[model samples]
Target: MKNLKIDREKVLLGVAGPVLALVVAFLLTALVLIVSGYNPFEPFELMFGAIGEQDVQVLIINQTGVYYLAALAVAIGFRMNLFNIGVDGQYRLAAMLSAVVGAHFSPPGFLHIVLIVVTAMLVGSFWAGIAGVLKVTRGVNEVVSTIMLNYIATSLIAWLTLKDQFGYQAEGSNDLTTGEISKSGWFPGIHVSDLAGDIYGFIFVAAGVGVVYWYVLTRTRFGFDLRASGASESAAAASGVDSKRMVLTAMLASGAVAGLAGMPVLLGQTHTYSQSFPTGVGFTGITIALLGRNSPVGIAFAALLMAFIEKSASQLSYATPPYPPEIADIMKGLIVLSVVISYELVRRYGLKRQQSRVGRELAAQAAKNRKEVSA
Candidate 1:
């Protein structure tokens, strides 16, 4: 019971870290405002109003899917301590390939659309597998390899977009992109109240990810082995778990999910891929993973929180005083830094508490045994 109480206290402490960080960050911002001779309270007041505005809310909603998908990519790899910096390359290449497939195939209906989406996942997984295979076979450091691969993937996609063989050619056009996909291949939007439907659908998808990923990590034998391998390769190997195989599988799975981040942009918004695809999403995944502490549910909230800040930053700038847009980036950095440090602190504290509780319990048991023997 004492142990349980300590565990509960640790959990509360973990939860409090983020809240504490927020307060600290706000106070720091207030200090900055004072130094700058600006009214700190005024900006915050305007921020509150901007958040309540409809257009700003919609913008935030739209960003939910993008952040959720990107974060999932980094979180999966983080679970294994694999730094998948090539998420950008994998996601972009898969988006281009999937876009081409979607455009060329001209699927007739829903089933065909499903097939195309699945194909995208395969392409994404395959792309990521390249890095995983390199790591497993040659002992290549994923950080260096993934970063190098990002350049290669970017060049390859750029070349493909301009080449005639890949069907990216236009008769007399400078833009290097394939034609738009058929309407049937699109992910249909949903209607939630008076607002746009894409956000609602995205929220549902994010929730699904949380549920499925949680199950995959906790309930399955594969998850157990993956976690074991992540914790220690030597220990896992001694236990007969193939660390290499798990690494490869986890990387592939992570990339597949990252690829899905483009689904909203490809199937819903743009209905096609282009050379000027959104790039920072994969990198942002790293920050999201840190903020989320590698938990799927935590990632969802982190993503949403990030999306809200980004959305509001833009709208608030337009509505009130034109503060520097880079403020959003600064805040994101601070949040991620705070969360990572807080998570580590909480984890360490929890472990210490458990150890102390066990020691006390054993000591008490020993004393009781001694008394009984004397009697």
Candidate 2:
């Protein structure tokens, strides 16, 4: 009963912390908006108004799917204490190479799409693997290695996108790209209505990735190893878990997922890799993962919240009073900060209370045994 009660309390904290974090976040954001001479309530009113629109709803859902993939990408690396800041690099490199590969091949429909996705994953894994190798083999910190890799990935992409490289200048245009992927390589978008855009075909793909992530992390020995290594590498090694191997596996999985961060555009909308293709999504994923506390369900909620904020902020341009989109950035930052602060406080308080409860229980048990023995 005592253990059950403790478990119940844990569940309560899990729910309450996020709720409180958002509360604090909004409060802080309101303060900022007031100080900056913006009517904070007006922005939210506009946001809620836009949320009622079908086109905006579809846009939010589609973007949430993309953000989920990105957050999952970062969360995987984070699980093992590996900061994969290089996710930006990993996904872009994968998308570019996969676009090139898809352009070069003309396979059947299903196979062509599958090959493109697989190519992205392989490239992302290899790119992230370099950071893992440096960490394990040369004692380099994963954070430093990944950060350095990001710049290298950017440079490589710049070089590869040049005309006469993997890409070529488009007809009558100055833009260089891998060119349009054939229809066979396109992931078929789920059409909603004429008023709204099609839902990203990769939405299901992201969902599958989340399911696999949760299942593998909770149910498999590899997951056990990964979690143990994350908890403590020395302890994990002492228990016969291969720390180095876990690092490599974790980094590879992280990068592979990061690879998908670009796919919603590559296979769903753009069908080509170019300089204008979305970037910085990897960084945004990191913030989302942190806000979500790195759980599958939490990540989903966080991604949706993020998408709503982004789309709603963008909508503010046409709102009655016209609030700036920069306010959205402020809100996002505050939420992340509030979550971190609130969770940390919760952790310390919970730990102390647990220790006190354990002490009391032990003392009570000792008294009971002493009285019985004396009698």
Candidate 3:
């Protein structure tokens, strides 16, 4: 009973931390808005009202798609203790490469779209392989190297959009975008209504990805080695784990996932790569990774929650003041902060309780032994 109570408390604490963080952050943001002469209530009403049937359909497809792919990408390296901060670069480069390939070989109908996506995955994986090689051979820290690589990729893509044969500029204009992908290259949105088409296919993809990620991370031998390497390099090495090889492989895998993330924005949403291809997706991965605690399943839920808040905020913007709608990012940050702090606190608390329990058990055993001997 006592053990069960302790376990229950731990579980409750885990759940409560994020919830409390969200509530407190919103209230605080609301207070700030009130002082700014805006009625928080009005905006709140508008935001919810904006979630009309049509908007709900779009919101689910766009925001949810981004969240799942981005979070999973981040979690891959997180599992291996390699901070692959180059998700932005990986995603951008892959997306552009995919677009370029699709343009090069105009296939028939859906085949064209499929080729572009596959090309994106290959390119993204290869790009990430650069960081892996550097880390394994030159001992370059992936965090630093990947950050620099992001800048290089951004510049390279920027250049590609302006150059001949690779120019993705608008006709007679210097707009930084590639030619629109073929109509057949686009992933058709699932039909929710005659007036509204929802991109339900992406949601289905996300669900599949979540399952695959969970299986790979928890059920596979490769997953065990990755976890072991993340937990301790020396211990893992001693156990015959090739830490370096794992790092490189994990990084490539992470980049591939990030590349897939761009598909939503590319094939599903925009059907082309633009100068604005890379948003804060890579950075957002950090938030999702932390919120999800690097668990594939947890990441899915956390990503959904974030997507929900973000979508809701956008929806509310139609009726409410900007305050309520703008509060999504703030809420996300607070939730992440709370989760981090709470995780650390709970971990320490658990360790102390474990020590106490062990000590008590040992003492009880000693007492019993002494009595038996005396008797």
Candidate 4:
């Protein structure tokens, strides 16, 4: 009974923080909408309605896979106390190069897809490894180095994608692309319905990544060392873990995952990297990682929630009073802020409860001892 009670409490405490944060975020967002003279409730109603639409559901699922991969990448870095802000640049560069390779290859069977994915992972790891090297060797902060690397990567991509370079301009299109991959290189997706469109096949790969992430973190020795180092570098070092090596490993792993973030869209939909390839997803991954508390399961839910919000928000512009689509951005920001505050509060409360329980147990034992001695 006691064990069961403790387990129940643990479960409740685990869920309370996120639930409290979300509730507070919604209330605060409502306040903002009221102050702006718009019906916040109406926007939420519309968004909820969108959840029932098949097409929107398909979009949310597709986007969730992308967001999940990105968040996992961020979570890997978080495990080792590294901030890999350059995931944006790393994935973009990886996708660009991988697209180039995919465009040139006409390998038979699944080899083409495998080649593109491996190329992306290698490129991303290499790009992110630079920051790790600087941090370990020169004591440069990963944050600063990664940020600088992002700028460099952006410039490099822009130059490489120029029409005269690896990129080419199609006859009728204004956008520059790495040239379309042959049909053999394209990823096959699951067709839902005519109205719903095809679901990204890479979703399975994302799910596999999450499973691997969970297993590695909770059941592996390397994961133990990585977590220990993140918790306290000196303590971890005393325990025989090499903190520098862990940092580099974590960054590389994170980058490798980030490299896959763009693969779903590129192979399943775009079939090429263009001047208009998605950006800022790496930054969004940071937000999702924090929201998910760095857990694989938690991250999955957070990614789904985020994707749902983004997809549903697109309908606001077509509403009767037409709320601005930016409202979703505001709500996301508020949720993130609320999550930080609520989690801290929950942590403190849980600590106090445990301390109180321990004190009560100690006092009860003391009282029993005195009674026995008196008898």
TM-scores for every predicted model: 0.89, 0.96, 0.88, 0.97
Candidate 4 ranges beyond 4 A from true positions: none
Per-residue accuracy of model 3 over 1-375 as CA lDDT, tens digit each = 988988897777666655555566667667766787877566556555656668565765577777788788888998898888898888888888888776668888778877987888888788788999999999999899989989998888878877675766666875666677877887776766665556646566767887888888899999999999999999999999999999999988988888888887777667667776657787777787777778766677777777767767765556422455456776667777766776777677777987998899999999999999999
**Pairs of residues at least 3 apart in sequence or in different chains that clash in candidate 3:** 43-320, 43-321, 46-319, 46-320, 47-316, 168-177, 168-178
In terms of lDDT, which candidate is strongest?
4
Clashing pairs in 1: 190-197
- Put the candidates in lDDT order, highest first: 4, 2, 3, 1
State how far residue 34 of model 3 sits from its true place (Å): 5.2
Flag clash pairs in model 4: none
lDDT of each: 0.77, 0.90, 0.77, 0.93
Candidate 3 off by > 4 Å: 1-17, 31-52, 163-165, 170-174, 194-196, 319-325
Tell me which of candidates 1 and 2 scores higher on TM-score: 2
The local lDDT score (0 to 100) that residue 14 gets in candidate 4 is 84
TM-score of 1: 0.89
lDDT of 1 by residue, 1-375 (tens): 977986788678766766666666666666676687766676566666777777667667767777888788888887777999888888888888888888888756886567666776787788888899999999999899888988998888877776664646467876667678877887776644565334435456656876788899889999888888888989999999989999999999988987777777787677767767788788877777777677787777778788877777664466445666666777777776666677677778778977997899999999999999999
**What is the Cα-based lDDT of residue 246 in candidate 2?**
95
Model 2 lDDT at residue 14: 80
